[model samples]
Target: MSPTLVFGVIAAYFILLLVISYFTSRKADNNTFFTADKQSPWFLVAFGMVGATLSGVTFISVPGEVGNTNWTYLQFVMGNMVGYAVIALVLIPLFYRLKLVSIYEYLRDRFGQNSYLSGASFFLISQTIGASFRLFLAALVLQLAFFDAFGIPFYVTVLTNIALIWLYTFRGGIKTIVWTDTLQTTFLLLAVVVSIIMIINHLDLSVPQVFTVVTESDLSTIFEWDWRSGQNFFKTFLAGIFITIAMNGLDQNIMQKNLTISNTGDAQKNILWFSITFFIATVLFLSLGVLLYEYATTQGIALPGRSDELYPMLALNHFGAVAGIVFLLGIIAAAFSSADSALTALTTSFCVDILGLKRKEHKNQNRTRMLVHIGFTILMFFVIIIFSSLNDSSVVSAVFKVAGFTYGPLLGLFAFGLLSKRTVNDKFVPFVVILSPVISIILDYNSEAWLNGYKFGFEILIVNAAITCLGLFLLKGNGKNERLNEAENL
Candidate 1:
């Protein structure tokens, strides 16, 4: 895989995305950019979301994870399925009935100005870090595959990647992302399927034999019965539920695509479809991990220091140019599918939630939105560079660890709003939201020593949310019905 050839493939991919953006953005207005004017096809949204949901982290980290965690991630996937059902049945209808551009507006309607700002602020912090983490993986891969070969610095590679995403996405936003993500998802899946076949053929194993090998291998372990281990089935499964509820159901980035559909019924259909497809996709990636580890053992290949490096090492160095090209395209597709939407969602949240772009009759609203869009792109660039310098673990773990703390506050806020009728003293929310994650970090750091060797995994999200919920409850106002009536009137 020549650096020039990899660069050429990436250029071709970007051209395709730009072509889609051109068509989608023509005659586009704020409405189209925000909600696709509520006309997106359910199936297209479903397909595109598969790519966005997986991102580059899953492309590389999920398979690599099998070396250590085996199939315990499947427990999380099952929880995700349950969470999606909850989103389709519970959250989507609420958003549609409310006619929300930014879902945080729900916090405003149910609570007050301070609550709304707190929710939006949490999303800004969470998404900035989350999106940057995903892009960090993508940028690192690009640096290894191309930039390093050219003696280019890593920050330059990060900027180049962000610039390309901004180039295609600055105009149309979610309208452009809906179609482009569908195409990217296709390539992302193709890369996985092709890589599997290549690995199987190289190992001289039949399809059934590949399955048999994986089943017989130690990496096939999926259930962890230990009560204290972080990967224990119940802990991981429950964490997955809250994580999906918070990260997908509550987060603006995933829900923005769902909200693009014309009606509640279609949105439900999109979520259900995406849920099933995402489960199957997880199985495929996990299966590929089994094969990769099996191939390494049988061929006596020295595995990399980091498990995350295994997929790329094999694909680029050993699996021939075709596999290398597929790997490059797959990662780029996976990375852009998620990154483009995050950029759009960050801009959308800032303009609609923070800046109140919709309320004001500004003549230059579109221009203002573009500047916000560019501002988030630059923010992601710096965040990725920061993450690259500081990260020390598998990216999949890092992403979920951060999510548990950041998204936990979101989960608590939404739960408190939906399940309880009481409103909190809105002004206290920012303090509570900030404090929850700080407490979670302290507990996470001392979990093993304090809990007598009980380690916290993704389930720490549940703890973080519980702490936030407790704080909000203590701040609860006495006039429950009054706030409920006010929300209804709003």
Candidate 2:
């Protein structure tokens, strides 16, 4: 793939997004940015969410993951389905009933200022890292396929990518995102389908033969029973359930999009089908993984030092011009789909949760939001650079690992608030949230040795949240035991 061609593809893609932004954001205001004026169609939101949910991490890492973990990631994904159900059946109604602009507002009413802030703060940390990891994957590949060809450095590429997101999202925010995301999801799915078809053709395998090759291959093994292993069924499955609840239900990034729908029923319906599309998309990527390795072996191509590099190397360098272009479109769409919304969600959280911009009258609310939006866009740029230096593990694993630690406090805070009425010392809530992850970290480090050879994987999030919940219980706010706060509490 010529660097010029890759540059052309990227330019065209961002131009399309800008066009979508223009139309969707016409007459956009604070309400438009935050909730799409609450008029978004459920199916569009559901479909667009498919791309956002997968992002660049799943786009690249999940397929590469097949080389080692095989289909075991599916176990966690199975848990993800159940987790989405939890979000739909439980959290969606709660969020809509509260008429939330920032989901963390639930915490403010349920507990107090500290608990609400703690939830929002943790979401910022968790989502910042998660979105960076996804963008890092896309940027890393872009560097290899485009930037490095011109001797451009990685940091500049990171800034350039973040800037593109900011340009499209700064005005329209979620409104622009809902439409743009649907387009990106199309490209994302197309890339996978095309890649799979190309690989099977290169191998000269018919449909059944392709199926046999994948099913018969050792790399397709989907389950692990070894409890000591990180990908064990129970651990990965449970982690899937909790991580989805924590990351999607609690995090502003996901629920922000969900909240765009007109009512709880539409929102719930959106999630119901989004879960199905998400699962199908993932399975396609995994199938692409199997075919990628098969294609590499048949062609005698050497594997990259890391599994994450294989897909891009093949698509851009080995698979010819069409696949390369498709790959570029897919990855760019993946990067923008997730990162743009993240920038918006982070801005939404900071304005509503931290600064109280929407709560109190301000001279210039739009100006304040624009500043916060730019602030987060800049924040993600540096975070991507930092992740480039520090990332050593598989990016998909790195993302979930970050989720386990950072999203834990929100999970615990929300769970304790909903499930038990025990109020905590409001001021001490942050302390409990902070201490929970630290204790979970200590326990995680020693789990294998200290817990009879048990290993902690994504399930570490469960432990992290549980510890926070325990600490909150110990605080037992002002001798009041009650229920999730009512509307009047707000």
lDDT of 2 by residue, 1-490 (tens): 8888888999988899899999999988888888888899999999999999999988999899899899999999999999999999889988888899999998888888878888889888888888888999888988998999889999999988888889998888899999999999999999888888778778888999998988999999999999899989999999999999998888898999999998999999999999998998888898889989989998999999889999998998877789889998899889779988988899999999998877333449888999989888888888899889987878988888878888888899888888876678899888889999999888988988898999889999999999988898898767663535763332
Output the TM-score of candidate 2: 0.97
How far off is residue 346 in model 2, in Å? 0.2
Give the least accurate 10-residue stretch of model 1, judged by summed lDDT.
481-490
lDDT of 1 by residue, 1-490 (tens): 8999989998898888889999999878888888888889999999999999999999999999999999999999999999999999889988988889999998987878888988998999899999899988888888899999989999999999999999988878899999999999999999999899899889999978988988898888999989889899999999999999999999999999999999999999999999999999999999999999888888899999998899999998888899899889999999889999999999999999998988333559988998999899999998998888898889999999999999999999999888887668888898999999999999999988999999999999999999999999999775653443233432
Q: Against the hidden reference, what TM-scores do the models get?
A: 0.97, 0.97
Candidate 2 stretches with Cα past 4 Å from truth are 359-363, 481-484, 487-490
The local lDDT score (0 to 100) that residue 149 gets in candidate 2 is: 87
Off by over 4 Å in 1: 359-362, 478-490
Give the Cα lDDT of each candidate.
Answer: 0.91, 0.89
How many clashing residue pairs appear in each of the predictions shown?
Answer: 0, 1
